[model samples]
Target: MDSREMPEPVSGHWPKRSSDAADHHPHVDLRPDGVTVRLPTPEVDWPSECDVTLARQISQAARELDVPADPAALQHLNVAVDALVIPEVLPFWRALLGDRDKGPEDLIDPHGHGPSLWFQQTDARRTGRNRLHVDVSVPHDQAEARIAAALAAGGRLVTDQNAPTWWALADAEGKEARVATWLGRD
Candidate 1:
């Protein structure tokens, strides 16, 4: 499934269920900002039927409890590190970050509190730009508003050629960050 096909929660909560048919319980994480339900595995682009059903149930439960959902407020943050030799740098970050979970090009926080780390491989050495940047992945519909807010706060658009997927921006001093979405990624 593409980004547009992904199911969204109705009450500002993300619900997830195990792919295992034997596990009937949905794990839910309640936070001050919102609720996140997770399975043993990370979220997939296309969720299973059970996952969708559990998401709906979680939404219903939230509504019953009068929980309001703010789609604009729902976002996931990650740190992107551009490296020419990822293998050489990956170990240091993993050790420094306290060893949670490692993917081929990413490091995820097992507890889901800290932002995930994504390593981008680059052939040429980058100049006049940061090697590390923040990636804020928000709902597709909210990207524009978020970009506008950042711009109004003195940030400038570095590039939007990747819009609907991401927009690179920079602070006054040129520190970079990207507002991204799952759109355009299949």
Candidate 2:
């Protein structure tokens, strides 16, 4: 099964100390440690769709929590590891990250603070290529600008076959990464 359709993090926040979007309500959970913004999306099967404007709101909420005003500091990241034999390797990672299995192919930080780790299965072994890449899921609308920024930073496009949804990119060292959005997953 494609896990992309799994529900994203559910809406939640502390009482009297939260800000949320109304329609597809994004949640702003203001905790002592910091603020956790659970961006909302339509009921379709995708992770979550965030609004770029929400980032500013989250930053303001973070400041209220006594954190810095840096937007990058509030971003969430996840890692995707491509493997041919998941069962053989999944356990080692589950033990290493101390994360709980969200599904047969995914793990999440028990603390809600670490980037999610997911395993993508491959049909045949590919040689001389990195098996891991970063899956940076940002607000759906911010994808193109982010892609452009990477290009400006000397990262070259690997493939855009999945573009407007996800772009495959390679860094100066040829390491691969994907700038993913919630566009096509719907």
Candidate 1 clash total?
A: 0
lDDT of 1 by residue, 1-186 (tens): 112222355333333222233354555565444455543236432234554465457556555556555667666788999999998999899989998556777888878678888899999899988889999977678899999999999999999998878999999999999998767765
Q: Where in model 1 is the C-alpha error above 4 Å? A: 1-27, 31-66
lDDT of 2: 0.65
lDDT of each: 0.70, 0.65
**Which parts of model 2 are misplaced by more than 4 Å?**
1-36, 39-46, 49-75
Tell me the TM-score of each prediction against the true structure. Answer: 0.74, 0.67
RMSD of each: 7.1, 9.3
Residue 55 local lDDT, model 2: 49
Residue 93, model 1: Cα distance from true site in angstroms: 0.2
Which one wins on TM-score?
1
Candidate 2 clashes between residue pairs 3 or more apart in a chain or in different chains? none
Model 2, TM vs. native: 0.67
